[model samples]
Target: MKALVVYESMFGNTQQIAQAVAAGLGKHVEVEVTEVGLAPDEISAELDLLVVGAPTHAFGMSRASTRADAVKQAPGGTIVSTGRGVREWLEAVHPGGVGTMVAAFDTRVRAPLPGSAAHKVAKALQRLSFPEVSDPETFWVKDSTGPLKDGELERAERWGADLGLLVNSR
Candidate 1:
């Protein structure tokens, strides 16, 4: 079995969660984790699963303006993903087939939010005809440019493991 985890991060919190998720999936199958900027525009038919993730901006997926604003937040600091995010990348992605089971995840502030990047990603994946393996998930962060909330990465890993087993059973 094989899976691809493509993620977009602004302050590296999402990247860390993606890596943790991939680590759990790795136990059940070969898994590749890549940033959205470096992710392929076309998902391979050979993949049994595709996991997409990003950091929520303005309550949903990041747009060019949101990304630019994020850069503004980081003044002289380093930003993990400086280019296109999940929203832009998904706009041009071509899935190999609808047979591939898919899942979505996102990182957002712990505070109550009206939207989610994961929700947006799940809807987009449905539009592309990817088979939905599970409901979207959210990992919380302490703040906008955040270190993820304690235990969120662990939760992501557990979610990934469950997703792996769920897909394998099908």
Candidate 2:
């Protein structure tokens, strides 16, 4: 199966997780890892699985409040939309029988408590009719900049491998 891993990272913590996911998935199937700023039109329709990840902000997926404070960010309407990285990528595709295998994951700081980016991205994917949706996953970090805590990358790898198995079974 062909898989794509897209991610938005501020201090490279999320990117590391994305790479780990790609590595784990690559062990079982062909995978492509890319930054989330890819043009919507650039998204390939032939992909069998789409995995998206981002850092959580403002108790949700990069909501507008968190994004706007940085610049004119916000992929969608919220920081979650911050340029619509995950939203646009999924939206740009015309998933037929196989796109239903989409999965979502997110990275967040484990302090003061907040939301998960995976939930936001998963919800967005579901709205577009991606079937057999897997549960959203969360990876914790030490602080805002994030060292990713412990065993997070290993967990990401496991998630990737498991997700690959799910798509391959379909």
Candidate 3:
């Protein structure tokens, strides 16, 4: 089955998790992974699964205000960091019931945990009518810029494997 994994990353931690998930999915089925902004219309209903990811910022998904501020302050919105790309990409998906299974994942600092990006993404997927929505996955980071504590990547791999099984069986 064809699958796609798309992610938004800051400090590259979420990107690493996206890669690990893609590698795990690659072991069992064909998969393509890309930064959320780089994804093209190649995604279609024929795709069996889609995984979306982002890094949690300021207790919520990144805001357009932040993006707007960055654009104003910097030439290309380079300085403002956000997880909004996943939401933006979701909006861009071909809209009338694409029939693809979807799952979401997010990376966040462990302390002062306000909420999760994965949960937010999952809810959004439900709104979009993704056929079967899986539980959101979360990975922990010790500092704002993280090395991912320990075993986080391995856990992400395991989640990917499990996700593959769930989608295949359905």
Index of the highest-TM-score prediction: 1
Model 1 alpha-carbon drift over 4 Å, by segment: 75-77
In angstroms, give how far residue 145 of model 2 lies from its true place.
Answer: 1.1
Candidate order by decreasing lDDT: 1, 3, 2
lDDT of 2 by residue, 27-137 (tens): 787999877766334445677878888877777666445556634432332322236555455557555553546778888877767567788888877776776447888
TM-score for each prediction? 0.96, 0.80, 0.84
Model 2: weakest 10-residue lDDT segment is 73-82
The candidate 3 region of ten consecutive residues with least summed lDDT is 74-83
Candidate 3 collision pairs: none
Q: What is the lDDT, from 0 to 100, of the residue 16 in candidate 1?
A: 95
Better of 2 and 3 by TM-score: 3
Better of 1 and 3 by TM-score: 1
lDDT value, residue 40 of candidate 3: 66
- Top candidate by lDDT: 1
Ten residues in a row with the worst lDDT in model 1?
A: 74-83
**Tens digit of per-residue lDDT, candidate 3, span 100-141:** 888999988888557888888888878877865478889988
RMSD of each: 1.1, 4.8, 3.7
